[model samples]
Target: MRRLEGTVALISGAAGGIGAATARRFAAEGAAVVLKDVADPRPQAEELTATGAQAAGVVADDADERGWAA
Candidate 1:
C-alpha cells in the first residue's frame, strides 16, 4: 500500500516548482491533495485527477488572511 493512502495533503504554492513536484509525489503515494496558489492551480489539479488521483485547486494568497478566509 502507498504511504499516504487515505491521507489528505494541503500544499501551498502548488502551481509550479517544488510545490508542484511535492503535490505530484503526494498524489502518487495515494493522498488526496488540495493545491493552493496565488494563481489558478485548477489545470494542474485537473491533470492529477485525470490520472486517477484525488486533487483540488484553490486560489489563495498565503500572505493574506482574507484570501484564506475565502
Candidate 2:
C-alpha cells in the first residue's frame, strides 16, 4: 500500500517552484491533491489528473480566508 493512499492534501503556492514539485511528489505517492494559487491553478491540477491522480484548483488569495470560503 502507498504511504499517501486514501489521503487528501491541500497545497498552496502550487503554480510553480517548490510547491509544484511537492504536488507531483504527493500525487505519485497516491494522495489526492487540491492545488491552490493566486493565479491560474488549472494547469497543475490538470497535469496531476492526467497522471491518474485526483486534483482540483481554486483561484484565491491565500492570505484572505474569504477567498477560500465554501
Candidate 3:
C-alpha cells in the first residue's frame, strides 16, 4: 500500500509491545523508523534493520523533550 513510503517516523515508547508493533508496521510500509524508549532496543532494531527495514533505536525517558532533541 506504500502507506508510509519516504516517511520518517519517530516512535516514542517503542522498546516493545504496541510501540514495537507500530514500528514494525511502519517499516513494513516503507518508513524509516526512529525508535525511542527508556530501555535498550539494540537487538530488536538490529533484527528489523537486517530484514531490510530502516530502523534505529534511541534510548531516552519520554518525559524529557531534551532527550528527543538529541
Candidate 4:
C-alpha cells in the first residue's frame, strides 16, 4: 500500500523551491495535496492533477490572518 494513501496534506510556501518539491513527493506517496503559497501554487497543483494525483492550489499569505477568512 502507498504510505500516504487516504491522506491529505496542506503545504505552505508551495509555489517553488522546497515547498513545491515536498508537495510533489507527498502526491507521489498517494496523498491528496492542498498547496498554499503567497505566490501562485496552481501550476504545481495542475501538474500533479495531470499526473492523476488529487491536488489543489490556494493563493494566501500564511502570515496574513485575513487570507484564511475567505
lDDT (CA) for every model shown?
Answer: 0.95, 0.88, 0.87, 0.96
- Sorted on TM-score, best first, the list reads 4, 1, 2, 3
lDDT tens readout by residue for model 3, 1-70: 7789999999987889999999998999999998878988666688789999999988889787787575
TM-score of 4: 0.96
| Angstrom error at residue 16, model 2 | 0.8
lDDT of 2 by residue, 1-70 (tens): 7799999998899888888888889999999998889888879999999889999877778799888676
The better-scoring model by TM-score among 2 and 3 is: 2
Select the stronger candidate by lDDT from 1 and 4. 4
Ranking by lDDT: 4, 1, 2, 3
User: Which prediction has more favorable lDDT, 3 or 4?
Assistant: 4
Between candidates 3 and 4, the TM-score winner: 4
Query: In terms of TM-score, which candidate is strongest?
Result: 4
Model 3 spans > 4 angstroms off: none
What's each prediction's TM-score? 0.95, 0.91, 0.87, 0.96
Flag clash pairs in model 4.
none
- Residues 31-52 of candidate 1 have per-residue lDDT tens digits of 9999999988889999999999
Clash total of candidate 2: 0
Clashes of each: 0, 0, 0, 0
